[model samples]
Target: MTWPKKYGGQERSFLDRYVVTEEFRVANAPVRAHFTADRQSGPVLLKYAADEIKKDVLPRITRGECCFCIGMSEPNSGSDLFAASTKATKTDEGWRVNGTKLWTSNAHHADYMIGLFRTSPSTEENHRHGLTNFLVDITLPGISISPVHNMAGLHEFNEVVFDDCLVPNNHVLGEINGAWKQATSELAYERSGPERFLETFYILTEMVRTLGTEPDNRSAEGIGRLVAQAHTLRRMSVSVNGMLQAGMEPVLEGAIVKDMGTVWEQALPRKARDLTAFTDIGNRTNFDRLLRYAIHIAPKLTIQGGTTEVLRSIIARGLGLR
Candidate 1:
């Protein structure tokens, strides 16, 4: 929602976008078709892409007709993004990309991928200096996607391979081999969003439904603590959105929000299960099913956007403790 008005975005305040995002998440809306583009890719294009690229992509994104997948982690990379070895060699026509991106979400259905690839050799003095960001057309030749299902038997994740895939010079985002400068700012957008905490919100809703208005002391206390935690996280997330709107990179604040939010969300299923242990078995069958699915999906929450350990390190560095 931060794109310019000319680009078909409403140019709404970040807080307005925050409200919309929270409403969608709480309602369990099927937003996966446009979530990545709306949340991170659109802002990235606005800030870094050329006018032509923005003109071509932003409107489609705003129309919810395009899907984007991030290509940051590789087989050996994961949270250590600097360890990525996917290569993009300069060619007479444009650039030739060859590598495999592991654990890329929605790659199978993505219209585009904002890929990070190695463009030069990393020196000992600056290991992060050699990477570049390219907006790859997923339908291009030499690009292949294979499904990598999660524990829930869902096929949302994938492995994408590039073999001499051609990326035009104009498709390069920001400066060549200077993507590191653009990365942290992008992550500030990615990590501070309401999605971090709201993924498991269904479990909390189910818990409340099963408990009804009047509850025992333990159940009430558990519900109160969960609600309080959710409120605190929403406050933190909204504050970061304000910072983003003000044109400041609140990397530390974003990291803290994601770190805490993801941990809480990852544990929410178990917490809800415990809180509803004494609920009438007859009324809890649906709750039990939702809780089971949440449990299955919980492990990936902390590891997806960024791992807990990596986020803690970022927060520590921001606090001058690392």
Candidate 2:
């Protein structure tokens, strides 16, 4: 509730917001209803969108009445956002977008999408140039959404195709052909959130419960290590949030938190599985089921937001190694 008085928010500090996010993740709250909007899209709009657009969208977002999806990754350009082929051509009516976006989470249910489209052709000297961000209304005509089921048997992702979808000029999100500048700052918000490290946390919690107060040395050691890792990542995430609140873009720090956090989260399920292997809990079926589900969904932890390889490259560039 703490956003800002102007945007229908409570104007809470980043630290306060971090507390809410951590509580939600630890409890496995069903926040999918408004997760993306609250986490990244709302802030992006507040920072770079037109005033009218902000007045239209920010209130609804704060009310949890609107959902948003990002439209950056295409079939041809997953990590290399500069290679996006989705074209947004200038028109008297506005910008007409025509292209496909893959792995668009919640596109099937999202009320809006913050899309990155090619506004001009990339020059050899600047491959990252020529991209533009748009606030696309998913209800607009000529847009098609098809489901992409994951290994977990969930239809949480979709392939969104835009065929001459018209967006008003007022919906343009920042400077035309300069979205790359805006993108890095936005990604820092995404990469450093608690979700980066907490996706598979339920499995660890369940294992601890199954192990009970008295655990073997091996089980105790495994649980201790997992707790330590989770605590360290939480500290890193909070530190990044502090940087963001100070109006500084800690892209390198965000990338490092995401890189290390996702790696640990992806490996957490397997580690929990091993820890629970020799457990003698008589009625631990629930724990077993959750562990299985965690294992199924664990593979995507490092792939989403940004892939491990992409995050490492950003970190390297920030460190002056690239």
Candidate 3:
């Protein structure tokens, strides 16, 4: 909704996008197919890509014909993107990439990847330098994807390897060695979303349905608290979106939203287990299966996008706490 009309966008407001996103998330729609493109990738290209690239790619994304994935978080680097060692050497033709990206969600299904590769060594005085963003066609030669099943036995994550993969010079997004500026601003789009807090929302709805209209004091109180927290998160997330709509980068606000939202969502299953322990909600809508799935997937929520520790460090530095 934020894109211009010529790029195939409706030019709708951010609040309009937020409402649709919230509904799809709560209804558990199969949005992963285009979620990355709709959320951050399209916006990234809109901001950093050349006019020709945007004209070619953004409309495809708007038409739901393209998918995108992030290419950060290498082995040993974890959330420390500055420490990434993935090399992208400049060649006579274009660029050759050689590295492995771990925990890449939806790489197997992606048409393109907004990958970060080190084009030069980091200087001692400025370690954030030398990293560059590239629009990688994952289906290109020398690029391969391997599935990394989660604890829930889901193939949502994959490991992507770049073995002398050639990327055109035009695919080099923004500055060659100045990706640090871009990455921080991109977080505002990545982290401030309803999905950050609503992944396991079904469990809560089932809990309420199981308890019926007249829950006991304990159950009612717990549900009330959870509802309040969810409401607060929604407000914070909406405010961040508003900031983005106004062309301001809400980096710190976005980090805080993800940190709090992920923590709350991660703990939801445990709390549901404790609160519903005495109830006989087993046969109602496969609560047992849903709970098991939530529990299994909960561990990775905080680690995705950005880890809790990394988020807190950003929050700290933003607030002058460091």
lDDT of 1: 0.90
Q: Please give the range of 10 consecutive residues that has the lowest summed lDDT in model 3.
A: 280-289
Better of 1 and 3 by TM-score: 1
Off by over 4 Å in 1: none
In model 2, residue pairs whose N, Cα or C atoms come closer than 3 Å (at least 3 residues apart or on different chains), thus clashing, are 2-10, 3-10, 3-11
TM-score of each: 0.97, 0.97, 0.97
* Overall lDDT per candidate, in order of appearance: 0.90, 0.90, 0.91
Count of clashes, each model:
0, 3, 0
> In model 1, how large is the Cα lDDT of residue 19?
91
Give me the runs in candidate 2 sitting further than 4 Å from their true place. Answer: none
Model 3 ranges with Cα > 4 A deviation: none
lDDT of 1 at 313: 94
lDDT of 2 at 35: 90
